[model samples]
Target: MSAPASAAAQDGVDRLTYAPMVMADLDAVFAIEQAVYPHPWTRGNFVDSLASGYSAWTLHDGDALAGYFLLMLAVDEAHLLNVAVAGARQGQGIGRYLLDKVAACARGLGAESVLLEVRPSNLRALDVYRRYGFAEIGRRKNYYPAHNGQREEAIVMRFVL
Candidate 1:
């Protein structure tokens, strides 16, 4: 079982460990990316984010990858660029755990708000963000590519810490 947020990954057995993402981890990360999203981020995207020094972090369940999140902290705001829990691990609270970690990291970086863009059609993710205290702040027209070569709108949400 996962422990309290205050507990480090090394304390006893929590089965969750996180560290700064390295280039080597991208292959697995990209695989998860492909499996989870129809409009998955390309290898170049992850590579460029790493090159630009974004806080790309990942979680592990023992030797297996559990999840990953990418965030950009700037000027009192943290942009949640991307976050994903491995498909088989979805209902296990790993997403919430990672989110809490992100919030904490943002707070440490002196951010007052956390911002993320979500596709309106992604009800599962919308539910998660809403339950986690994010509220809709705005919308982006045709922000995401959709089925049938169409586009989907994005809901912009913010969580004030």
Candidate 2:
């Protein structure tokens, strides 16, 4: 069966706002990560991202967390490190919204391109990246640690801003 209609509606098609993530958002953001990712990032990771000055954002709809993304900026590029829409809010264009916001931020920062890595097995995410004009440039072997102590390869994708 497909996801509930309400859940689909929560995918951010309506009145949603995007803003830079702050320290106060860590709790809700980490909760979403724990709910959605198999190998979720720790609180430390999020803290470090903020501390190290990564560009991060959260999508909200009347106080509900719809999604978030974390990107690192370099001289002429932005690297997307983590991105996710709430599990129940998938397939409703939330990812696209987040991507657009990231691209805009990159442009504002004078970036020429955006880069990201995704697990080869995550076809859904890969498709989303492709829809945003991200092209595979290379692969990193054993990049993602798996549950059974195994590792999975990650496909590196890039989009020219």
What tens digits encode model 1's per-residue C-alpha lDDT throughout 49-144? 999998889998787888999999989999999999999888667777888989988898899999999998889999989999999999999899
The TM-scores, one per candidate, come to: 0.91, 0.91
lDDT of 2 by residue, 10-122 (tens): 54466888889999999999999999888999999999999999989999877888899999988999999899998877878888888999899889888999999999888
Clashing pairs in 2: none
> How well does candidate 1 score on lDDT at residue 129?
95
Candidate 2, residue 26: CA error in Å? Answer: 0.7
User: For model 1, where is the 10-residue window of minimal lDDT?
Assistant: 5-14
lDDT of each: 0.89, 0.90
User: How well does candidate 2 match the true structure in TM-score terms?
Assistant: 0.91
**Given candidate 2, what's the lDDT at residue 101?**
90
The numbered model that scores best in lDDT is 2
Q: Candidate 1: what lDDT?
A: 0.89
C-alpha RMSD between model 2 and the true structure: 3.4
